[model samples]
Target: MATDPIHQFQISRIVPIEVGSLDVSFTNSSLFMVATVAAVTLFLVLATRGRGLVPTRLQSMAEISYEFVANMLRDAAGTEGMRFFPLVFSLFMFVLFANLFGMFPYFFTVMSHLIVTFALAMLVIGTVVIYGFMRHGLKFLGLFVPHGVPGYLIPLVTVIEIISFLSRPISLSIRLFANMLAGHITLKVFAGFVVSLSALGAVGIGGAILPLAMTIALTALEFLVAFLQAYVFAVLTCMYLNDAIHPGH
Candidate 1:
């Protein structure tokens, strides 16, 4: 039987379990998340196990990833931001690996789900809120108060700023979720066309050529998008962390 394209996105329980009112069952999504984490951990551990003056390919790649995220944090939030390098780097690697892994056949796209992406977004914004208050105390409220505005306009501007600040997690989650969902759906539709058209006749087989070509092209584009989205997530994270560090203007 031809499987449904949408079925790829469905969350199925591998082991059903519950505690009180909460359904904390083992699921496909949960499995992929664990695999993603293990893959990243093993990649870094094995890559740097033999750190030497003459680095191997894995070592070089690890170093590049490290420097790339370090430079990103440095540029976005400055030297003080290096303190959060573990947080920023972990987020980048996790998202990047999750995105890339999802491109494989039969692998679940974790970030394609709204709940997963939303949780990640909330984790980021929550960190910003917690650290912002802890680091700057009540001064963190200054982030919502713009400088050099007229007294009469300050109230309106502050309200707008507060709304914008609150919308960060929503915007962040939606961007990742929508992009992944749309890209995968488009790819699936095109692929289905290839399969359906090939079954009709000789003419239909010839007609499938266009969709096949487009599918190939889209596959490449999706790879680029996967990397770009992960980078964007990490970059925005650094920018938000900057607010925690300098919560003014």
Candidate 2:
């Protein structure tokens, strides 16, 4: 074995099934996505099914999640944004679970891939643009043309603002993909050290202990990153939605 931990990024076909025009091959990446979605749905559905007032731990978690997102939207986008809470809550939970699920042994990290993250960013940015236009029509264009700037400098400022707005998807996707990919790769690298060194003999086995300890520490940090990344994604999304709602503000 070469012992290069980064080599695990390969996306393998679990089943090379082909359907005439569709060619619906199952892949490791797709498997993780399905698992993440299933995990999120099962947790939420099962957690809230009882609707208990005394509340078990699962129910408490579910209630906390609801209040967190609901309050976030209310605070950021005001009462009008409450209508979109279901979509936003689901989005946050899905991403949170997806990132958290990937931290396990032998699990495929879907969020580590740019295609997955980019697709998510596109959906968010697309909704912002579409809703902005629907709500404001041509007036939505005014979002890029900020107020308080002199008419003489408006063209220059408008171009800069437009460029920045266009960059949103790029930033959002790259931040998530890079963080997930880096965290997993780091853990893998440390683990490879533990395996390779322990195989060498007594002295090497002593060195292996340190790598094992490091792996545990890194694993815990990776879990924190999973939650942080999800929170960042949800908060940024709310902020962007806020702009669409209050264009000039």
Candidate 3:
């Protein structure tokens, strides 16, 4: 069969298992997800293992990663937001590593999957909602009602705000999932073109040059997109969490 670019996204069972009606089989996706977690855990642990007055390169990297997310949360939600540092940092690292790991050949990109991304998005918004209510009581509903609006406009504006708030999870998830999916698919298609063109003859060899160049260029761009998407996901989560912190705004 001709290689299908979309086939790269397929989930295959690695170890079949069943518990009653549930097919809780281990899959390629599951394996990569576990690997991603293990990789991140090891990176941070090893990088920071030797905390020193004069930092080693790995320690510097670990510190840089910590400060990056810490500053992001601080800027978005202020000092109080630091309380959620563990949550935000974990999300950022997981997504960032998953993205980078996916760029490797034959590795599954968990974030590219809608279910995975949507679940993550839901967790973010769910945390916001739960904490908002817990911290602010009924006042948390103020998030859907802006301050200083004319009485007549308040109803309309509040409805709009509620819709926007509700749409966060969907938009957040789709943004990450779609970006990763489209970027990878484009890379694969261009790569396949290079192979297909090179197979033809002398003319084919000449034709392959364009795709070969495009593929190389896109490889660099894809790496950027991978990091950028992860950053976007983390920043947006901070912003959303900020709303929960200060719903009056």
Best by lDDT: 1
**Which candidate model has the greater lDDT, 1 or 3?**
1
Q: Residues 3-109, candidate 1, lDDT per residue (tens digit)?
A: 36786788999999999999999999999999999999999999999998899999999999999999999999999999999999999999999999889988899
Worst 10 residues of 1 by lDDT: 1-10
* TM-score, prediction 2: 0.93
lDDT of 2 at 241: 85
How does residue 131 of candidate 3 score in lDDT? Answer: 97
How do the residues 1-249 of candidate 3 rate in per-residue lDDT, one tens digit apiece? 245888889999999999999999999989999999999999999988898989999999999999999999999999999999999999999999999999998888888899999999999999999999999999999888877889999999989988999999999999999999999889889889888988999899899999889989988998998889889999999999998998884
Task: Give candidate 2 misplaced runs (Cα > 4 Å).
Answer: 17-23
Candidate 2 whole-model C-alpha lDDT, 0 to 1:
0.88
Q: How many Å off is the CA of 185 in candidate 2?
A: 0.5
- Candidate 2 vs candidate 3: the TM-score winner is 3
Q: Provide the clash count, candidate 3.
A: 0
| Model 2: per-residue Cα lDDT over 1-249, one tens digit each | 447776667888998888888877899888888888898889988999999989899999999999999998888889988877887887889889988888878777889989888998888889888988899888889889988999999999999999999999899999999999999989998898998999999999999999999999999999999999988888888878887777773
Best-matching candidate per TM-score? 1
C-alpha RMSD for every candidate: 1.0, 1.8, 1.2
Ranking by TM-score: 1, 3, 2
Q: Please list the residue runs of candidate 1 whose C-alpha ends up more than 4 Å from where it truly belongs after superposition.
A: 1-3
How many clashing residue pairs appear in each of the predictions shown? 0, 0, 0
What lDDT score belongs to each candidate, Candidate 1 first? 0.93, 0.88, 0.92
The TM-scores, one per candidate, come to 0.98, 0.93, 0.97
Candidate 1 has an lDDT of 0.93
lDDT of residue 224 for candidate 1: 95
